[model samples]
Target chain A: MTLLHSRRQKEIRKRLEGMRPRLYRVAFAWTHNRSLAEDLTQDTLVKALQAARQLRELESLDAWLFRIMSNCRRDHFRNQVSTENVDNYDLVDERTPETRSSEQQLIQKVRDSVEALPETHRQTLTLVDIEGFSYMETASILEIPVGTVMSRLSRARARLRKLLATQHVDVRGNDSNARLRRIK
Target chain B: MTEMEHITEEMLNAFIDQELADNDMMHVYLAMSKDPDLRDRVCELRANKELLRAAYRQVPAPRKYQRPPGLLPRTAMAAGIMSLGVGALLGWYAHSFSQSDNPPRTVARAYQTFDSKVKVVFHVSRNDAAAFAQILDEAEALVAAEDDKRSNNSVRIVANGDGLFLLSAKASPFKDRIRILSEKYNNLVFAGCSQTQKRLQRERGLSVDLLPQVSTVNSGVFEVLRLQEAGWKYIPI
Candidate 1:
């Protein structure tokens, strides 16, 4: 029995191992803090392994792992919100170099826009667009209805467009070339 | 276009995502063909989705974590200390178990049965013996690890195109490993594409004999796609 139990754990580890990158990506996208993302991913993995026996089917593992991650992230925020002021997280450093290229600036601007979105919308966008999950898949991962996923995704994209416009990056994540356009 | 309601953002979003019903999808397509404004909106949405995907796809996966292979090994201790340690361990275990049972904050689906069976489909388009060997190694590792978790496991290596060469009895250098893997893992399978075989016959007038362990499939690409639709993770090698 001991040998058999150990064998089962090895298998669980392998399956979870393949998902590390994807889990980290989702975690990093959410937290925008590499260390926290790593921590979250690690914790999620541990919890998933402990609960592996409860998993009834292999097909649901992706969504199951993601759901655990989603909860882990939320719990982290709840603990963080009570002790720290998360409002100042957006304060930018004024000492940044001026030699940054327009491309870098546009990338930064897009990142900021995505990071500023409401948590639900950001997650929806990340899972659907970045992760290439279908609407139903995203819904399953987020534990929301398909309609909610659609609305959140739509709103997130619209918000990103508006936010990027303010930073002078066009909706497509490029520098605005409107000034170069010939006036018709 | 003139008779219908103006396209709402939701409708346009749905169209962009290809989530619309067939009639509605056609309606949007027809509208875009005639209305440049509608076309531009779709373009904007497409561009936005593209930009988002490009930005996030670059984030690398986490460094591979090295976890202990199993529970910590039992240690030797004095009898009194051992008794004390056992009690503490039991208490800690109970606490952790209860904590884990808390209603998960996110929406969770019913436990699925896939836990009992892991389905993997390897798409092999090359005949590299070295690469195929690596695949077998990975599969072996998976089977070993899964021994405790599921009662059954499935790993399929679908060879097509030039990849069929890896399974060819006449040319494969790793024939010994392939045979060994087949003998060891009853759940593992090697599949050769019949379509590729037919093409080879027609184009080169060559007939290939696959290892006896390999089964023939109608089409490699079709098999991969079908397996993906069936929820098997597709690993392209």
Candidate 2:
């Protein structure tokens, strides 16, 4: 309507752009497939832009975007969940046993362990641990009770610890060629 | 010091995650200090969370987003940001006026009035009553002078920070005068900055109630920039 209004709209557009990588990481965690994750991220952003006016508070932005992403991810799997290829999950370590740097292997193991978790628990864990969302915000994003979020997160962590046998994360990407760079 | 048997895994998780309330948080601290095993268990859960956080932060190389050109280009109701020279400013002014709810003749009449007057923006970011008095004096005089000639020229007062007092419903001393002047001048706008309002609430726990006649913008500084970019004379008070 006015340049001032356009500039304000552009501010929102810029914010959405800044959120892309974070959205992708969450999406990737959900789908365990890069392209699907990318598509989910892209769709979530486009939907967010279209529905930007509906968002009233900036403090709730992370929860709001993740909610949109959750919807998009749900919509994607709604019709395709059963028919989707199980082997398409390429989260396995890409390197040969000799060539595999332990860090890459650990990264793959983390992805696999997380994927093995129940969907609700995995969502709670990633939202809290990875995105640093507070328990309340995670509850809102996942549309569950705070008590439920805490329980799911607790179960997820316990299962992860058992899966990895209480392993601590110490491996940095010591080798450049064998490294998985930090994303989001 | 609390008993080792008292700490549940949920409370330990909440404590390690810093999700516990202040009182319970202290309770966990007391228990952990009293019991070595409790501390060790909290440390383990904390470490596991850190591990997940770290591992997920790493990933394979990403394919560039094939974002189509003009992913969010201008819509019918909105336009792109245009460089405003002397002519461009008037054009944009007229363009904006045209889009307003005013009738066709009013748009033309308002354009003429805008062209004749030097548009003004008064910026206030302080609670100094003296400065506010000066701003009110200058603003009232400017608009009243234009009223003598029967012109509805535009003026804006963009306030943020402590300057928001000028628009505060209960705090503003010149509430009656502002209401009177606003009623007299068709295009005089009083805008409060939302950023400052949010900051005040978050930091100082103040809930600001603006005067009924005033509107709000995302940022007061941004409003100043908007007016100046559109060729309005900026007078910071």
Candidate 3:
């Protein structure tokens, strides 16, 4: 039993080492700060090492790690509010000037659209739309019923549609290309 | 791109992941046949998701791990050294606070105003000096760019419990930067919990320096609740 436990621990470490880079990236995306993401990743690894014994046999390691990562992020965010005095920093990708401008506009539009959503709707969309969590997984993570997730997601999508439609109308301004783009 | 008229983001996600139930799949197909706008929105959302995923696919893991002290098996000599150092730093910072004229109320008010403008909280629990330093740098950069109009715009850094380690002089990860930021941004306040300090002193003999900008509070959790009551926005970074 001791030998088996030791072997399992070794395997977990190896698997964790392999997944570190990817986990860090997700953390980075969540926090938009390299250092915080790095810290979160390390903390996740350390906790994973400690609580590894509790992971049941049926759970996928990847999913389990992701759950840990999400919890770490939430905890970090909660602590950040209590400990550090700083503003929410958004991650802006740098591309070509034209591309950057367009992307920025799109991102701003999307952010505004998302921000307008109620907290529940926003979380559902963010997890499903932005973070790529499945309906079932998001439900589990959020500790809500699945039907609620679907309903919130549906409302979120409808709100986004309205926002996009409004933006399209404002941008067209009767220009042929703009109008064509809007219609298309 | 025009073919986008037949898909919804939810439908596309479902289709891609093969998660749509039989009834939902039929509904999606029927909806696609009837509504182009739904399809376009889904396409746009799908494209955005793909772009975001591609942009942030690789998360970096730390190459070198610095184990925190609690995790390490302590030698008597190492423990003694840490204890002595902690004692001295704590005494020094406490003395400095006693000598200073800026009362707690003034500091609290300044912090309150900062919270009104742009409240940010930093969470640090790791003993890694480099990592802690980087967190301070990020906070410094953000505070530097903050607007001057918001006099109440404050950053209260509450380091409590294990997080108080960041304030230690010997192991203080962000001492220099914390000092600089606290000075420049009067709105920036660094605080460690008194309880944690006592624990550090009694158990580990480690003393945390409470620099002019850094102060010791009764409890970290209490500080969080107070600032939150004062309407400071919270983020755990």
Against the true structure, whose DockQ is highest?
2
DockQ of 2: 0.16
- The complex in candidate 3 yields a DockQ of 0.09
Q: Give the per-residue lDDT digits (tens) of candidate 1, residues B1-237.
A: 441247767777778788789998988888888887777778888877876775676663332332335633232113323432332232223223324545322100111323546666767877766657756765665554544665366778899889999999998887888899899888788999887887788789989889998999866765665575455655555
Instruction: Give the runs in model 2 whose Cα sits over 4 Å from its true position.
Output: A2-5, A82-93, A166-184, B64-237
Clash counts per candidate, in order, are 11, 0, 27
Query: What does candidate 3's lDDT look like per residue over B44-93, in tens digits?
Result: 54554443343344433332233355665345335433432332222223
Q: TM-score-based ranking, best first?
A: 2, 1, 3
lDDT of 2 by residue, B1-237 (tens): 446688776777788789999999999888788888887778778766766777778655344343345665343112222221232333334334434675433222333444466577777877867656656655665565544463555678889889998789999998997899789776778899887887788789998989988999866765675575466755554
Q: TM-score for model 3?
A: 0.46
Off-target runs (Cα >4 Å) in candidate 1 are A2-10, A85-99, A171-184, B1-5, B60-237
Give per-residue lDDT, candidate 1, residue B158: 93
RMSD of 3: 17.6
State the fraction of real interface contacts model 2 keeps.
0.37
Candidate 3: list runs displaced more than 4 Å: A1-5, A85-132, A155-184, B1-17, B34-38, B58-237
